[model samples]
Every structure is written in C-alpha cells, then in structure tokens.
Target: MLHHQAIITDIKAIIAQSQEKAIRTIDHQRTLMYWAIGERIFREEQQGKDRADYGQHLTAYIAQALEPELGSGFSKRQVELMRQFYRTFPIANTLYSQLSWSQYKLLLRLDSHDQRTFYMAETVKNNWTVRQLERQIYTNLYERLLVSNDKESVLAVAQNEQLPSDAKQIIKDPMFLEFLGFRRESAFYEKDLETAIITHLQEFLLELGNGFSFVARQKRIHIEGDDFFVDLVFYNRLLQCFVIIEIKTAKLTHQDLGQLQMYVNYYDRVEKLPHENATIGILLCADKNDAVVRYSLPAGQKQIVASQYKLYLPTEQQLLAELNKELYSFEKGE
Candidate 1:
C-alpha cells in the first residue's frame, strides 16, 4: 500500500512539473513571436526613412489593421511599444527567454538604456515577479543606489560584477511602505508599525532590497539581567552577515543610534561567526535629522546606519529633495 501511494504521488509531481515547463516554453515562443513582429516593423520603418512622418503613419495603419484581425495586443500603444521594444532590445538574439510579455512591457517603460539594462539584469538575477519589479520601479531603487555609490560601481553591482562591501551600498533611506495599507495620517506606536512590517514580511523583504531573508521578530537579547527585544532580524546572504533592525515611530535621535550600536556590537561579538562578515544594524524610523545621524555615529563607523520609512509614496519634488540632500551629506561623510 505504501509503495502504491508513493508511485501515485510521484506521478502527480511529474505531471505538475511537466505542465510548468510546457507553460514556460509557450511563453518563450510567444515572446519570440512579438520580437519577430517588432523586427519586421522596424525594418519597414527603416526602409521608409526618406518620408517625413512615415513611421508614425505606418504604425497607425498597422495598429488599425491588426487590431481588427488579431485583437487587443496589437493596439496603437502596444504596437508602438513593440517598436520601442525592438529598438531598445535591437538584437533579437539577445532577448531573455525567461521573461514573459508582462515583464517586457514593464521594461519598455524605463527611459534610459543603462537603467533598463540594470533593471533587466537585476530582474533576471533576482527572479522577481511582475509585482516585485513594479514595486522596485516605484521605489526608485536604482536612483537610491546611484546616490550612494559611483555610477560605474552601481552598474557593476546591478549586473553582479562586484560585491557590496558596505550595507549602505544596498540599503535605501526612507523606504516606501505604501504597500502596508497604512494611511499617511495614521498615528501608530512603534509596535504597531513593527507589527505591520511583520505582517507584510514578504513585501517588506522585497522593499528591503535583495538577498535578505527574515529570521526573527522581537528577538530578545539579555545584558546584565536587562532584556531587550530587537524589532526584526534578517540575514543577508550577499553581505554574509546578520542584519539587526529596530523600529522607531518618531524622529530619530542620538539615543536611538546608541541603542542600535549596542545591537550591532552584540551581533558582531556573539552572533557573527568567524567565517562571516561583521553584522550590520539598521535603525529604521519615521524621520531623521541628517546632521544628528551624521554626528551620532563615530567617524569611519561601518556597521550602523539610520534610515527613514514612509507610509506613502513620496512626490517627485520630495524625492528630488531627498536625493540632493543625501548626495551632499553622503559625500561629506556626515
């Protein structure tokens, strides 16, 4: 009876695996078809380069004719997307077979060649779902990295050409938590905010950027008979270290930095293995004075960082202000 049951389970597993592979193959073929269509349109447009506005007219005519015969995917905007897609990708041979139509559609929206390439390399490297990719874009992850590191390093790290030596290289300040379903006006305790992050742990990890895996919440530590609970703990495989995170509901202060430094010290002395890198600590709070943070940590401190968190997506102006502020401060070592 046991043998029979095992055989049945194995058969079911094989069938499921086969179906998954079949779907992937079909999606790849569909992607290729779109690429081929794009190539044809691009070649036609190139041939008619002598005529002013011919490309626009050609695309419009193609959309009108294709929509009636083939359906929704060939609409005006989408046909243009196909054209842009081909132009951006250029070589059909270089198209990533693992990507779906939806992923390609999102990639088309990025404005810069470098940005598109970085995001694509990361998307493939991280095996991100469409939702995760969308969230990364809205959070402006690429720009955040650029502010911290040189352009060459940023591109290199994105494509896995170099490893991150400091946690700040990968960490984003004022991480967006709009996915937590909390209103910006909502008043909450640190515990309440921590609870929300724990509840939406997956999204939080995604927002935390790559190579992070959750370990514990409200992790308890004892020192000279006093007990303290770290709000969250995670291990970053890429960094080869443990990350201790503390949550703060209001403005950050030197006291908070001291508390975080203690945690980092504890992890480095006790939790970190000889083979592992020094553990890092992040004090995630609702607001921060950059001057305060700058002065709080010792000169050449490597293990502790403070960053703010927001309940809603910041406006373009707000983000721009932050980028300028951070760029100046980070360069000044403040």
Candidate 2:
C-alpha cells in the first residue's frame, strides 16, 4: 500500500513539473512572437519616417485587419506597443516573459539604457508584479538609488540578488504616502491613518520599500506591571531584526522617541532570539522635529530611525525637487 501511495505521489509531482515547464515554454514562445511583430513594424516604420502620420495609421490598420484573423491581442494600442517594444529591446535574446506587457511599456519610457536595464534586472530578480514595478518606477526608484548608494552597490542591487543589508540602502527617507489620500490640514487621528494602512497593507508595505514583512498589527507587550502595544511590527529579512513601528498623526516629540526606545529595549531584552540582532524602531509620524530626533538618540545609532509620511502622491515636479535636495546634500558631502 505504501509503495502504491509513493508511486501516486511521484506521478502527481511529475504532472505538476510538466505543467510548469509547459507554461514557461508557452510564455517564451508568446514573448518571441511579440518581439517578431515588433521587429517587422519597426522596420516598416523606419522606411517611412517622412510620412509621420502614416506610421500611426499603419499600426491601426494592421491591428484592425488582424483582429478577425488573429484574435484578441492585436488592438491598435497593442500594435503601437509592439513597435515600441522592438525599439526598446532590439535584441530579442534579452526579452523576458517574466515581465508583462505593462511592465515593458513602463520600461520603454525610460530614457537611459542603464536605468532601464537596472529596473529590468531588479524586477526579474525580485519577481515584482506589473503594478509593483510601476510603483517603483513612478516613485523614482532609479533616482533614489543614485542618491543613496555608491555606483557599484547600486548596480549590484539592480543586477544581482537583493541582499538584506541593501534594504535600507534602497529605502527613501520620508517616503511619500500620498496614496492614502488623507488631508494634511484636517484633524485626522493617528489611529485613522493606522487603520487605513492596515486596510491597505500590501500597498503600505510596497511604499515602505523592500525587505519588510508584516509581523503584527497592534502587537501587545507586557513589561513589569504595565501592558503596551506597538502599532505595527515588521521583520526586515535583509536587516535581520524585528522592527517596531510607532505611528503618530501629529509632529514627533521627545516623548514619542522615548516610547519607541522602550519598545526597542523590550524586544532586545526579552523577545529577540539569541541569533537575531537588536531590534530597531521607526517613528512614522505626520511631522518630525529633526533636531529632537538627532539629539534624542545616541550618537552613531543605527537601530532607531524617524521618518515622516505623506498621504498623497506628489507631482513629478515635487519628486524631482526632492531628488535634487538629496543629490545636493550628497554632493556637499553632508
């Protein structure tokens, strides 16, 4: 009976493996087909550069004609996408099916070859979905890397395995939180924001950058005679530490810092495993007193960090301005 069961398990495993292999093969073939269409369209377009309007019309004409014969994938937009796809990646060997059409569209918009390559490599290495890839690009992931890391490390992250130590190196301080759509001028409570974050946990984590995995919402701790709760607890696989996060809707104060310090101390003393490093704390507040944070924490302390969150996505101009600020500081050797 055991032998029969083993044989059945082996058969099921084989079937699963075959199915996965077949899926990969189909994906590869479909991507190659798209690349071929792109190549043909691009070559034709190049020959008629003098007739600029004709180029757009040609794609629509081809898509309209192909629809009845070829089926669903050939819309006018998709045909234009095919042309852009070839223009973006002329080398068919480099095209990866792991990246969807949406991701390709986003990548093709990047002006720099190195920037596009970096994002492609990271997106594949991290297995980021189309939405995740778009979010990273829109958030200026490439620019953020240029600001935070040396060229070598930045390239390594873009090309190779995403190591845990590199998480903070990639994270942007004062991450824009405008996606939440909270009114800065309104009297929204901290709990209100926290609830929203919990409701949209996946988006929140993506905005939080990489390496963070949600551990708990309102995690409880008991110390001596009192009970305390942390708003969020996450573990950064790369940093190898438990991250205790405190949320505040108002400006950060010394008292807030002290409370976070207490949480960090508690985790270090009681909750942290022997192999794990000391816990780190983050104060995600609506506002911050940078001076208070600087003087309140011990010098050269890497464990605790304070960053403000925004509830809306900023304009491209705002993003560029912020990028310039980081770049200027780096150039000044600050």
Candidate 3:
C-alpha cells in the first residue's frame, strides 16, 4: 500500500513538473513563431522599396491568400499586426512568447517605447492576464511613475529590470473593483463586501493591482485574552511580505489607520517569518483624505497606504475627469 502511495505521489509530481515545462515551451515556440512572421513581413516590405502603397497591397494580397487557410487571426488586421510585430520588435530573437499577441498589440499602441518595454518585461515576469495589462496601461502607470519618482530611478525600474524597494508605492489600490458586479452608492455591511471578495477571491486579487495572492479572509489572531479577526490577508511573492487589508465602507479616519498600524506591527513582530520583510497595511476605504493619511502616519511611512475603491467601473468621461483632477492638483502643488 505504501509503495503504491509513493508511486502515485511520484507520478503526480512528475506530471505537475511536465505540465509547467510544456507551458513554457509552448510559450517560447509561439513567441518564436510571431518573430518569424514579423521577420517575413519586414523582408517583404523592404523588397517593396519603402513604398507604403506596395506594403499595403502586399499585406492585402497576403491576407486574402492566408485567410482561407489560417482562419480569423490572419485577416488584414492581423497582417497589419504582424507588420507591427516586426516593426515594434526589430530583432526577432528578442520576441518572447510568454506574452500573447494581444499583449504585444497593446504594447504596440503605447507611444512611449520605454513605457511599453517596461510593461512587456513586467507582464512576462508577472504573467499578467490581458485584463490586468489593460488596467495598468489605462491607468497611465508609466506617467504616474515619471511624475512621482526621480527620472533615472524610475527609468531603471521600468527599463533595466530593477525592482523597486517600495513596490507597494507602484501598486494602485481601490483598483477598479467594479468587476465584483457591485453597485456604487449602495449601502452594505463591511462583512458582505468581505464575503464577496472571499467568494470571488481570484477576481479580487486581479483587481487588487499586482503581486497579490490570497492568504486568509477574516483571519483570527490571538493576543492577550482577546481575539481580533483581520478582514483580509494576502502575501506578495515579489515583495516578500504579508499585506493586511482593512475594508471600510465609511470615510477613513485616524483611528482606522491606528488599528491597521497595530495589525501591521503584529504581523511584523510575531507572524512574519524571520527572512520576510515587514508586513504592509492597506486601508481600502470608500473615500480617503490625503492630508489626514499623511498626518496620521509617521514620516517616511512606506508600509501603509490608503486608497478609495469604487464598486462600479467608471465611464471614460469619469476617468478623464479624475485624471484632470489629479493633474490639476499636481499642478497646484497639492
């Protein structure tokens, strides 16, 4: 019986490892294939001798021929994508298949090469889904970094693969939680939201903005004679620490910050492993006062963050208005 159990365990382990390797190999091959396609398109364009009309005609011709054989992804739009695929990444060998064609298409749309490259690298490293990539890009993450940080440091983090010490600062929060299918301005108990997040934990993690994985929901911690249940706890693999989140339906207060501080301190001093970094706390509130947060937290406070979350996805106009507001505040030295 024991021998059979051992054999089963071994087989399962082998299967798991093989699946992982196969996925990587598939990604690598797909990446290489796109590179080759791009190369072929480039060569054809070069043969047309810098004539834009010839390039379009050739693409149309090729699309007509290939569409019947290759199906939908080979239409004129795809051929254009292939051309862009090569133009965006001149070196075929540099193309990585770990990221899908859609990801490349999004990156190609980005005006800034540095920003695109940064997102590409991070997407590969983090295995960001298409939705996550879209969110980050739409949020103007690159612009935010350029404004908030030193040029050299920000560029290095974006381009040279230098992981920022304060990665939390780069992580946005209250991150468009409308995916939960919750209505904005609806009154609900905090427990209801917590339960929903726990129920749809995977979606919640994606909405939480990067490097987050579920650890516990309403996790109980015993201290002295009393027991406190943390609303949500997650661990960030990239950052190497526990992230404790407190959900608030009301406006954030100094007391809330103080409570979160205690939780963070507890995780840091007692729960965190010796090798792990200090725990970080986030107050996910319906509204936040930047001035209050700044005054409540200590100086050089990198561990705690307060962000407002919306239950519904904002419309384009709403997003634009928010962006204008942010820009206006920044301009006014707020």
Candidate 4:
C-alpha cells in the first residue's frame, strides 16, 4: 500500500512540474516576442527620425493596426511599455530568466539605472514576488539603506556583494509603519502600537529588513523578584542572534536606552547560546533622541540600538535631502 501511494505522489509531482515548465516556456516566448516588437519599432523610428517625425503616433498607429486583429494585450500602453522594456534592457542576453513580465514592468517604473540594477539583483537573490518588489519600491527600501552608507556600499549591499557585518548597516532609521494603519495625530498606547505591529507582522518584518523571523511578543523575563515584558522578540538567521525589541509610543529617553541595554546584557548572559553571537536589543520610539542615546551608551557600543518609528512614510524629498547630506558627510569622512 505504501509503495502504491508513493508512486501516485510521484506521478502528481511530475504532472505539476510539467505544468510549471510549460507556463514558464510560454512566458519566455511572450517576453521575447514583446522585445522583438519593440526592437523593430525602435529601428523604424531611428530610420524615420531624420527624414520625418513620426515619433508621437508610431506606437499608437501600431496599436490601432495590431489590436483589431491580434487582441487587447497589444494595446497602446502595453506597446509603449514594451518599447521602454527594450530600451531599458537593450541587451537581450542580460535579461534575467527569473524575472517575469510583471516584474520587468515594475522595474521599468523606477527612475534610475542604479535603482533598477539594485532591485533586479535583489529580486533574483531574494526571489521576491512581484507584490514584494512593488512594496519594497513603494517603501523606498533603496533610499532607506542608502542613508547610513555611501552609494558604493549601498549598491554593493543591494547586489549581495557585501554582506553587512553589523546592525548599523542593516537597521534602517525612522522605519515606516504606515502599513500598520496607525494615526499619528490620535492618542495611542505602547501596547496598542505593539498589538498593531504584531497584527501586521509580515509587513513589519519586511520593514525590519531581511532574515528576521518573529520569536515572541511580550516575552516575560524574571530577574530575582522583578518582572519585565519585551514588546517583541525576533531572531535573525543572518545575524545569528536573538533580537529583543521594545516599543515606546513616546519620545525616547536615557532611561529607555539603559533599559534596553539591561535587556541586551540579560539576554547575552542568560539566554544566548555559546555558539551564537550576542543578543541585539532595539528600542523603537516615536521620537529618537540620537545625541542622548550616543551619550548614554559607552563608546563603540554595538549591542543596543535605538530607532524612531513613524506611522506614515517619510516624505521622499526629506529622505533624499538627508541621503544627500549623509553622502556628503561620508565623502568628507565625517
């Protein structure tokens, strides 16, 4: 009976594999066809540019001619996207096999080659779905990571060429929790904020950067007679340690830093295994007092980090200005 069941399962698996292969083949063919059409259009445009100006209505005319006989898939907008796709990915051989048409469309929406290359490398490395790619772009993942480092290091990190050796390299400041649907103007408790984060845990993890998985929430720890509850606990496989996180809905203070430091020391001494790295404690506050935290911690402290959280995405202009400022500082060795 076991042998027969195993055979049946194998047959089902084979059938599923064949179906996926067929789908992939169809998609590959579709992508090639689109690229070919775009190339043809581009060549024709170049030839006609000096003799006459047919640039504006070329795709429109092509769409009108093709759609009636072929279908709605070759509409004006799609054709234009195809043209852009060819222009952006000029060399067909450089196209990634893992990327689908939908993923390519999202990549093309980005403004710069640097952003496109970073997302392309990340999408393949992480196997990000189209939805995941879109979310990362919307949250400005590139810019967030770019803030703490120079452009070269940022791009290198995105390309997976340089793995971050420290939390400072990976932990983005002023994390955007806008997806949690909290209202900044309204009154809310720390518990309420933690509950919202746990409720939307996956989005929160993505915001936290990669390799982090939830471990516990409101984790109780008893030292002597006193009790403490950590708002969130996560483990990062890449960092090879437990990450303790505490939530504060108000501005951060020296007390919060001291408390988080104590948590880090507790975890390192009591909970951390012999082989694992020391525990990392993060204090998430509504307002980050950077200078105070710097003064509170000893020089070159790596275990505890404090970061600000926002209920809404920060303004792009503000982030860009900060990124430029940071880049300048980095260049000047500040």
lDDT of each: 0.86, 0.81, 0.78, 0.84
Residue 92 error, candidate 2, Å: 2.4
RMSD (Å) per prediction: 2.1, 4.3, 3.5, 3.0
Stretches of model 1 off by over 4 angstroms after superposition: 1-4, 49-52, 316-321, 324-334
lDDT of 2: 0.81
Model 1 clash pairs are: none
Candidate 3 Cα deviation (angstroms), residue 192: 1.2
TM-scores for the candidates: 0.93, 0.78, 0.81, 0.87
List candidate 4 stretches off by more than 4 Å.
Answer: 1-25, 314-334
Candidate 2 or 3, higher lDDT? 2
Q: How are the candidates ranked when ordered by lDDT, highest leading?
A: 1, 4, 2, 3
Top of the candidates by TM-score: 1
Of the two candidates 1 and 4, the one with more favorable lDDT, higher being better, is 1
lDDT of 2 by residue, 1-334 (tens): 9999999999999999999778767877777788899899877877885657878978999999997788868988788888878878889888877776667888988898878887898788778887888888887877776775765677676575546464446565667776677775777777888888888888787778666799998899998889999999999876788988899888899999999999999999988999887798889987897779989999878778787777777888898799889878877876
Q: Give the alpha carbon lDDT tens digit for every residue of 171-244 in model 4.
A: 88768888889765888899998889899998888789767899999889999999998778999887889999
> For this target, which candidate reaches the highest lDDT against the unseen true structure?
1
Error of 2 at 219 (Å): 2.6
Q: What lDDT tens digits, residue by residue, belong to model 1 across residues 1-334?
A: 9999999999999999999889878998988888878888888988895644877888899999999999988998888888877888888788877777889889888888888888888888888888888778767788888776887787787889999888978888768888888875877788888888889998898788779999999999998899999889999998999999999988998999999989889988888899999989999998898789879888778898887888888877787787778778778866
